[model samples]
Target: MLNSRFDMKDMDLAHVILGIKISRTSNRLTLDQSHYVDKILEKFSNDDTSLARTPIDTSKHLLKNRGEAVSQVEYSRVIESLMYLMSCTRPEIAFVVNKVCQFMQKPLNSHWKKKKRILGYLNGTVNYGLHFTPTHLYNLTWLVTRMRTGHLIVMMRRSTTGIACFWVQILSLGNQRNKRYTVSRSSTEAEYRSVASLVAEITWIRGLLQEIHVHSSKPPIIWCDNSSTVRLTSNPVLHARTKHIELDLYFVREKVQQKN
Candidate 1:
C-alpha cells in the first residue's frame, strides 16, 4: 500500500530495533534485550557482584532519605537505564523499579543498594523476554492490587494457545504516576479508580484493533481481588458513602452497562 504513495524501501527482515532483539520460531515470536541488559550491568555493577534471585527484598521497607545524597546523578542514570529495560521487555521488576524511582532525586546509600540488587537480579535473568504466539482467540483481563497507600494495576491477555501475556505498555509509561493526585478514602474507591483507568485503556486498544481490521468476539473482563469493588460496579444504587469517588464510580458503571 505504501509503495503506491510515498517513497519507501523494503528492509526485508528485522532482528533488532532500538536495542530490542527479536527472535522468531514457527509458532512464536519473542523479544529480549540481553545485550542492553549486559551493558547496563557492566556500566553500573562490578564483576564480583553476587547475583540476586529477586529484584527487591519484600521484608525490607524503603523510607525517604533524610541524609546526604549519594551519587545523585549516577543514581538517576541507573534508574533511567532500568526504566527503559522495564518499559521494553522486563515486567517482573516493575513494582520494585517504580518503588525505588520515588527516591530518585535524593537517593541514599540504601536506595543505591536496592538499585544494585536489581542489577544483580538482572544478571541472573538476562535472557528473559516477552513471548507471543499465533492464536485465534483473544481475551483481555485486568488485575488490580490495592494497597494501603497505593495501588498496582496489571493488565494481561490470553490467547487460545493458553499462553498468558502481561501487557505492561501502559504501566511502563503512563502509569508511573497516579491518575488521581489525591488519596482515596477507602480501598474500594482505589479499586474503582483503577478499574476505570483500565477500561479507558481497553477502549482505546479495542479501537486500534478495529482500525487494523481485527475484532474480538467478547468484551474484555476485569478480575479484581476486591469483592466490594465488584459489588459496587454492578450495584444500581450509588450510596452517599461513595460520593467522594462518584466520578470514577459512574465512569466504571457506564462501561459495565455498555458490556465493556
Candidate 2:
C-alpha cells in the first residue's frame, strides 16, 4: 500500500507483453499475438506460401532421418519460436509442434516441410486469440477421450489420449498426452490406464480451482466410451484378467470412490 511504503505504480493498462497482445472490455478479455506471428512468417519467408488447411498433414509419414538432414539449425529455431507461441496463445498447434520437435537433432526435408506448414497455418490465422467471458459453472463440462492403445503409431505402439475441458461452449483447455503402455493383454487394460491418467489430470485441475476459491456443488462427470473400463473402476471386485493392471485399478477406483 502507499501508506505502507510499498513501491508500486499504477499502469493504466497493459496492451502487449512478450509479443502477446491483450485486449479488454467491460465483459470480455482477449489475448492474441498477430504481430509476433507476422514476424515469424516474414523471417521464414513463408508470407508468400499458400495457406495450409491444417497445421500438419496427418497422412504424411515422417520417419527418423535416415536420409540427408536439412538445415537442422534453422529447423530448430523455427520449432522453438512456434513452441513459445503454442504454449502461450496457440495451443491448437501443440500436437503438430510436439510431433516435429522429436526430430530436432536430425531433421529431414519432410520434417522441415511440416514445420513450414505450421508457419503457413499461422499466417492464415494471425488474428486468432483466446477469449475469456463470464460463464456459470453449471453450464461448463469436461470431456476426456482416448484411442485404443497401439492405435496411434504402429511402429511405436503407443496410444494417444485427449482431454478437452469446456467452460460452457468456450474451450478452457484442449490437449493430448501420448501414453506408452507396457504390452497389455487387451484393449480394455489400455483404456483403463488412459482413464487413470485422465483422472490424475482432472484432480489437479480441481485442486487449482479450489485454490482460486471456485467451488462446484456437484461432482464432475467424465464420459468414457469404454464401458468395460467404466465398470472396472466402479466395481470393487478384482477379476482374474485385471491382475496385470492392479495398480492402475486401485488408483482409479480410489478416485472414483472419492467422487473425483
Candidate 3:
C-alpha cells in the first residue's frame, strides 16, 4: 500500500535481451528470434547453406543417442545451447535439438555435422520475433454441454475461448462405421450424424471449460470441414433424409437460428 513503507525497484522491461527476445509497447508485447537467429547464422556462416522447405526430413529416422559416447563437455554445451534456444524463441530447433541431444552420450560424425548445420540455421534467423496480439476478453456463452469422445468432436479448448480461432486434429478410431446408425442412409442423414458427433464434442468441451474457468460467447461455433454438413444443418424441416434425426440435433439449424 502507498501508506506502508515498502521499497520496490522499478525495472524497465522494454527491450529484447540475450537469446530470449521480448518486445513491448503500450498496447502489445511480442516474443521472437529474428535478431538471435541472424547472429547465430552469421557466426556459424550458414547464410549460404541451402534452406529446406521443411524442417526435419520426414523420411529420416533419428533416435536418441544410444550407440556410442561423444566427448561429454562439448556435446553437453551444444545441447544446452539448443535447449535454451528452443525454450526461448526457436521451436523449429526442438526436433533438431532433441535429435542432437540424443547423441550427447555417444555422438557420431553425422550427428556432429547436423549440429553444425542447425547452428548455421540459427545464425540466419536470430532477428526473427514471434508476434502475439492482445487477448480479446469475452463474457460467458449460453450453450448446453454434452460429453462424447472421438475424432469428430475434439475441438481445442484454446480456440473456443476466442484466443485461437480454429485447430484441427485427425484421430484414428477403431470403428470405421457408426454401429448405431443404419448404413445407406440419405446424404442428409449422414450429414446430420456427423454434426451430432460434433455437437456432442462441443457440448462436452464447454462443460469441461466450466469445470475450469473458460467461457465464450453464446452458441459456440461448429465449423464442419464438410460444407454439405453445414447446409444440412441450416435447414430445419426434417424430411425423409433428416426426419430420423431430432430438432435438438440437426443442431446446425437450431444453433444458427439463435445467432452465434
Among all candidates shown, the one with the greatest lDDT? 2
lDDT of 3 at 169: 17
Which has the higher TM-score value, candidate number 1 or candidate number 2? 1
C-alpha TM-scores of all predictions: 0.85, 0.84, 0.44
Worst 10 residues of 3 by lDDT: 156-165
Candidate 1: tens digits of C-alpha lDDT, residues 91-195: 777777877887887788878888989999999999998887776765555555544433321111110000112342222222332334456666677667767
- Per-residue lDDT of candidate 2, residues 1-260 (tens digit): 57469878788789999899999999999999999998888898454477877897877656774457899889989989988888788878877776788788888877777887887788789999889887676333566666543434335655566666665456665355464546555678777887777778778877877898887767776777888998998999999989988998999899879976
Clashing pairs in 1: none
What total of clashing residue pairs does each candidate reach?
Answer: 0, 0, 26
* Poorly placed runs, candidate 3 (over 4 Å): 1-6, 25-28, 34-54, 63-70, 138-260
Instruction: Give the Å error, residue 136, model 2.
Output: 4.6
RMSD of each: 6.3, 3.1, 12.0
Ranking by TM-score: 1, 2, 3
- What Cα-based lDDT does every candidate model obtain? 0.73, 0.76, 0.50
Best by TM-score: 1
Q: Score candidate 3 by lDDT.
A: 0.50
Candidate 2, residue 134: lDDT:
75
Worst 10 residues of 2 by lDDT: 146-155
